[model samples]
Target: MFFKRPTKEVERERNQRLLEAVYSTKASWDHARETERAVYEANVNSELHYRSRIQEQKFLYLYKIARKFKVHGKLNDGVIDR
Candidate 1:
């Protein structure tokens, strides 16, 4: 049926959006973590301070991403959960 077909497509599209949003936000968080470690090791006082702020920003973004993912559907937040 035409309605059935459209419904499937709609679900598929919805899934794609949710997946993309989740993955992209996760990647951003990972990058931030990497930066945090790299900066911490650098031993540069000023940059380390900046990195602290960056780390906080990244965490805030990560929270938003998790909320977004939850809004779409209840997905496993493995690291965040632990």
Candidate 2:
């Protein structure tokens, strides 16, 4: 029979260390993912804000152009006697 070297207690200690290392690594990756998601959401919001501003400007410009072409009624005829 082959003789095992590491005692059960030593094996348990080593496995605990490895488990802690893996847990820390996962936590760091989750933090990075959350940060990236926040940045993407902010970028989308800024783009939408810019687009709304541009649309408002275009509407104002069109209103001005339409006002320029307005027609005024002329009252040339005097009151008619029945």
* RMSD versus native structure for model 2: 34.2
Residue ranges of candidate 2 with Cα displaced over 4 Å: 1-4, 41-82
Candidate 1, 1-82: lDDT as tens digits = 5555446677668667766666666566677667677777767567655655665675666567556645354556773764
Please give the CA lDDT of all the candidate structures: 0.63, 0.51
**Clashes per model (N, Cα, C within 3 A):** 0, 0
Runs of candidate 1 with Cα error greater than 4 angstroms are 1-6, 42-82
| Candidate 2 structure quality by residue, lDDT tens digits, 29-59 | 5554555566766665465445445555554
Query: How big is the positional error of residue 31 in model 2, measured in Å on the Cα after superposition?
Result: 0.4
The lDDT of model 1 is 0.63
Per-residue lDDT, model 2, residue 46, is 60
Q: Which candidate is the best by TM-score?
A: 1
